[model samples]
Target: MTIGIALLTLLHILIPIYWLGGDLGAFYSSTFMTDPKRTVGERMMALKILNNIDMAPRTTLILAFPTGFALAWAKGWLAVPGFAVVIAAVAFLGWLALAWAVHLNHGGGAGIKRLDIAIRYGVLIALALTGIAGVAGDVAIPFFIALKLCIMACCIGLGLIVRRQLVPLFGAIRTMTSTGPTAETDAIIAAVNGRARISVLTLWALVLIASFLGIATPV
Candidate 1:
C-alpha cells in the first residue's frame, strides 16, 4: 500500500510538470516566426499550439491534486487541517483556472486574464505551503519537495515574462488576419516569435530539471 501510494503520488506530481513543459515547448516553437511571409494558416497553427500548451498545466493540476491528497491520506499526512486545506484549495484553483481558460478561448478574454493571474498566484502560495509542510513533516525526500517549489517559482516567473510579450503578438496576429501587415505589425510579429522560441527553450530546461529531481529522488 505504501509503495502503491507513493507511485501514485509521484505520478500526480510529475505528470503535470511533463504535460505543461511539453506543451509550452510546442507553443513556443510554433510561434517563433517573425517572417511576414508566413501565411495566416501558419499563424493560426501557432495559436492552436499555444492553446494546447495552455491546456496542459490545468490538466496536470487536475490529476495531481486528488492523487496527491490520496497519497497524503494514505501516509497519514492529511490529518493536518492546514495540509488538507492547502490541497483542496490548490485543486479548486486548478479546476477554476482550467474552466476560465476554456471560457477565454471561447472569447472571455478578461475572465481568462483574471483567472490566469489568480492561478499563478495561487500556485505560488500552494507551493510555499506545501514546502513548509514537507519540511515540517521532515519527509525523507525533502529534495523533491524543494525542487517542486523551485520549479513552481520558475514556471511563474517565465509566465510573467511571456505575458508581457503576448500583447504585441496578439496585435500582430490581429493585423495579419484582418488588415494587411505594416512595418509595426512586422516588428511585433518578430518580437512575439522570438519570445515564443525563448519561452519554449526555457520550458524545456524546466522540464529537464523537473525530470531530474523527480527521478533522482526516491519517493
Candidate 2:
C-alpha cells in the first residue's frame, strides 16, 4: 500500500508537467502554423508537429481524473470503494481509447469527435457539481481535492471552448489549402489565434493553480 501510494503520487505530480509543458509546445507550434508569411507546406509541417505534441496534454487531461482518484483513495483522502476504483479504471481506459481514436482519425472522425465532446460535457458538469457540492459541505470529498476538481472542470471547459473557436481556423486552413491563401483566410486564422490565446492563457493559469493546490493541499 505504501508503494502504491508513492507511485500514485508520483503520477499525479507528473501529470501537470506534461499537461502544461505539452500545451506550451503546441501553443508555440500554432504560431508558425497560422503565420501567413510561412509557406503553406511549412505551416502544414508546424500543424503536424503541433498535433503530435498536443497528444501529451490531451492524454494527460484524461488521465488526471483517474490518477487523482486513485491517489486520493490510496491516501485515504477519499473513501472510494475497491469496486468503484475498478469501475473508474475501466471508464478511464474507455475514454482514453476514444480520445486516441479521435486524434488518430481526425479527418473522418466527426461522429467520434461529437461523442467525445459529449462525454467531455458530461464530465465537466459532473466535476463542477461535485466540486461545488463538496466545497459547500454537501459531499464527503476533501476541500482541496474538490477545489482541484473544479479547476479540472474549468480546464476541460476551456479546452472545449478552444476547440469551438478553432473550427473557423480549421475551415480557413482548408480554404487556404484548397484555394490558396487569401486575405480573408489569413484574417480568419489570425483572428481565431488571437481569440484562442485568451483561453490558452487561462488554461495555463488554471493548471498552475491546480498544481499549487496539489502541492500545498491548502485548508
TM-score of each prediction: 0.70, 0.96
The TM-score between candidate 2 and the true structure equals 0.96
The models' CA-based lDDT, in order, is: 0.63, 0.90
True lDDT of residue 1, candidate 2: 60
Candidate 2: C-alpha lDDT: 0.90
Tens-place lDDT digits, model 2, residues 111-134: 988889899999999999999999
Cα error of candidate 1 at position 79, Å: 7.3
Model 1 worst lDDT run, 10 consecutive residues? 60-69
The positional error of residue 60 in candidate 1, measured at the CA in angstroms, is: 2.5
RMSD of each: 4.4, 1.3
TM-score of structure candidate 1: 0.70
Which residue pairs collide, candidate 1? none
